[model samples]
Target: MEEEITFTVPIRPDMELEVTRVASSVAEAMRLGKDKIDEIKLALIEACLNAFEHSKSKEKKVHIKIKMTDDRLEIIVRDYGVGFDPSKVKEPKIEEKLKSPRKRGWGLKIMRSLMDSVVINSHKGGTKIIMTKRR
Candidate 1:
């Protein structure tokens, strides 16, 4: 059986921690390992932050949906803001990032590295980031 929960909140900085905490609790309830739970928390925060920083949605909100099963967890982060091509975004160089620290581009890379699967769909209308992890 699969269970799902959905929530939407304005793109505010304070909401980031709240969303992360709730998602972490859901992962815990599904009996995912501790390390996996940590990864989920980080990914969720990054996704939300990206929406707030990049998405110029008129509503200024992000929608988060989490689906849980016995063996896996899937999360979708959606934004109504103007979307840009994910392919156009270049991967950050580790060496360059080390020399000068800036905070805008690392979220996607970190999420991909931590999750089992990361799929990004973006068009002029909106962007949806789908991430999944398995036990």
Candidate 2:
């Protein structure tokens, strides 16, 4: 059997931990492995952070939807802001980061590295990211 959940919240930095907790609870209810749960938490945080940081709308909000099944978990994070091309985002080189010591970028890379699949849809209106993890 599969279950679905959806919710929306403000795109504030302080809400990041709260969003991670909600994702963790759902993953725990689904009896996901500890490592998998950890991955979900991390990915959710990255996704939420990206939405909060990138969104340009005055409302500053994000919508999150989660679906769970016996062998898979899917999460969607959406932001109603000015969107950009995901392809334009280059993967950060570890050596370059160490040399420049910058604190921007890397969220998409981390989300992709942790999830089984990550699909991004972005345009001038908004951005939506669909990520899935398989057990």
Best by lDDT: 1
Kindly list the per-residue Cα lDDT of model 2 for residues 6-119, writing each as its tens digit.
Answer: 989997767978877888899888888999999988988999988888778677889989999888989999988999899898789888888886857999999999999999
Q: Total clashing residue pairs per candidate?
A: 1, 0
Structural similarity to truth (TM-score) of each candidate: 0.93, 0.94
lDDT of 1 by residue, 1-135 (tens): 899999998887779888888889898898888999999989888888888989999999999999998889999999988998888888988787778767358888999999999999998888999999996
- Candidate 2 deviant stretches above 4 angstroms: none
Question: 76, model 2: CA deviation in Å?
Answer: 0.4
Q: How many angstroms is residue 77 displaced in model 2 relative to the true structure, after the best TM-score fit?
A: 0.4
